[model samples]
Target: MYPPKSFDIGWPDLAYGLAACGRDGDADRWAATVERRFGDGGTKGPESAAGSGANGWEPAAGGGANGCLAALSVRSALDLALAAAALPRGSEVLMSAVTIPDMWRIVVGHGLVPVPVDVDAGTLLPAAAQWAAAATPRTRAVVVAHLFGTRAPLDSLAELAARRGWLLVEDCAQAYDGPDFRGSPGADVSLFSFGPIKTATALGGAVAVVRNPGLLATMRALHQEWPVQGPGDQARRIAKYTALALLTARPVYTGAVTAAGLLGRDHEGGLQERVGAFAGTDLMPAIRHRPGPALLALLDRRLRAADTVRAVARRAAVARRLVVRLPDPSMVYGADAPVHTFWLCAVPTPDPAATIARLRSAGFDAARPTSLGAVPAPPDHQQGARTAAHLVRHAVCLPLRPGMPDRVLDRMAAVLDPEDWGPAPGP
Candidate 1:
């Protein structure tokens, strides 16, 4: 059995991420901003960092010059964008059926209807044909989600949106480190997340980049109406992030995760139950709160230190090795793209549950990626959408992170070889 430590994070990366939580010499300035915005005697200390300049918060210095607005979370950023677009109530916004359910809630919360389209089984991207088939008189926008760090067909989707006079939104929460196409010709707006599990961890934060000046102004105005995160909430977030940084550290994380796996309590659903979010059951507040200065500072530091080219090359090398060993058609995606980033090396299998169990018993962490629930099918692509859903149900994502050990990769490859294991049982 491969050690549980193989699934944990690297020591250097964890230390670097935690270093951002240190004092950045902006505490006094942040406190003054909080007092000026929320008045004196309020949640005043580090706890009120996210609440500083509630109504007056502008995008972090360099971010605004390019029309990118920062928010507390991606869900809030999307909500702000939808409101800024000012689409008619009940207008339809199409999305891939194989996405996180939180996106559905955001669209519905904005009083807009979410139309689901099927994704390409291999790429996990909705094709232009799927989008065209989903279009209708009421369709007002299309959100192109770039899943698992792969780019979507932005040029084609942009042309379709332009011809149909519909808004084009790019969901780059998982693909932030993959490519920098925010202001590209085809996309009207893009949304990103800086959560703990993302490519770079900022604890909790999100950003929205708007290409249209009118939309940016509208979003900024809407941003002021939402209540700022209170000092208590800020404190909780800081504590949570801090705890995560510590928990994911090498020695501690390995022991904790290994024990949890042994106890049968380390599955994705169980983890979600503990986190109380991301499963679409516990909805987050729909307010457009800004990320605290500390979090932003951390994000900025991480961005500066990131080497996208090297990261992608490293991931590609590992992926290629796995492909050579496993030789499964469903083991990889978008290998032919101009650029590829392996956020999660997902493989489609006939029995996802069994495969996950086998991997877990072998001391490797593996599980199915997030999927939408109860999504309504597009009027014209029901069969295609169903096919996509089926594929998603059977796909299992392998554990792959930068700087992981070669032994771990070899173990994974060995486990995937069919000769080592006979026929998989039915779900």
Candidate 2:
């Protein structure tokens, strides 16, 4: 069966990471190199970069000296940004309705309310007007996540935030295409991830561009106080992913699935647990830390060495083929973005459990996205996020990978044809 996801890391990078784990490299030096290389921490393109040329792309500097900060993960970065912002207790953070549950959890953890703005599954973007309607006097910030590898239109959201004096953050965790296509120009901060499942995976890390120098400094100071991750932790991660990476092979995965069934094990559950960044650990403590030296070194290397744009282009090409074959194109989520890399292409099915069974029968191991959810709309704005909630309920992602054979694409499309996977007929 086809695996549901592929780690972006290669063996060479893994080997390099393993070697770096043994070195006593200066964490500060590697972190500084990453921060400097990523630009002055503004979307202002590479000009903010201490040096440029190879992969320089940031949007706008936001009228100040921008700075970049490195963290253990995007989850860690947001925690720092929110803590530094130090918004008043009970303030509301306007957010795109659909996102990983942890993001809203982070907001709540900081004593703030998350007001979810509805999104169009096609664009994976919340309408700006909906954002306006959702924002109350208590709203102090907006966190817009670019979901499913699609870059949402940021101009209007940025304008709204600027008009209301609200902090605007772009969660580009799933939208990192490469050195180019930096976060939106109008955003106060833009976050990028390099986790186990994200593009250009460094196994685990995050980089953020902070438009406000003061906030950056505050986050930096706060980040420094957190304990550093141990080298052994990263070493285990490298080893784990290396083993998981091997299961992408069809024969091994097939045999493993059979073995799992025979042993009465929930194989998918086991996979999710293994892939989790902090599986079985308490949330806050696990994330509140400086990167270990090994992570820093590997993150810097992956940023420089990752040939991301081409990889994204290849995926898009395959996704386009799939979309063309769908019985109803609208069944596919995130098809309306200006640029969709199809990082995790999924379809909204009326019966997702049945759909997964069907895909599995056809040699595809489809699964629901356990990591994503609709940030429930607040009490006053309950109707605003229906679409986001609907999509989350019905979405089941197929296993679409780079370099997949043409036969696989054709067969996958056939499974989605009108006779097979489309919505039910009228009564």
Candidate 2: Cα lDDT at 196: 94
Model 1 C-alpha lDDT per residue in residues 1-427, reported as the tens digit of each score: 3222121223454444344345343422432332222112112222333332332232122111346676777787788888888899989898877677788878888888888877665566766677887787999998777777776557888888988899888888767653344434678888877665666555566667777889988987877676654434444555655565565555666677777768977545654443432433345563456555555544443443336446657765776666666746444644434445666666667677788777866666676665434356545434446645665667677766556577777777777757433221211
RMSD (CA, Å), each prediction:
7.6, 4.7
Q: Looking at model 1, report the run of 10 residues with the lowest lDDT sum.
A: 37-46
Measured by TM-score, how close is model 2 to the native structure?
0.91
Q: Considering every candidate listed, which one attains the maximal lDDT?
A: 2
For each candidate, what TM-score against the reference? 0.78, 0.91
What are the clashing pairs of model 1? none
What lDDT score goes with residue 184 in model 1? 42
- Candidate 2 residue pairs that clash: 40-66, 40-67, 41-67, 43-58, 43-59, 43-60, 44-59, 44-60, 45-58, 45-59
Candidate 2 minimal-lDDT segment of 10 residues: 52-61
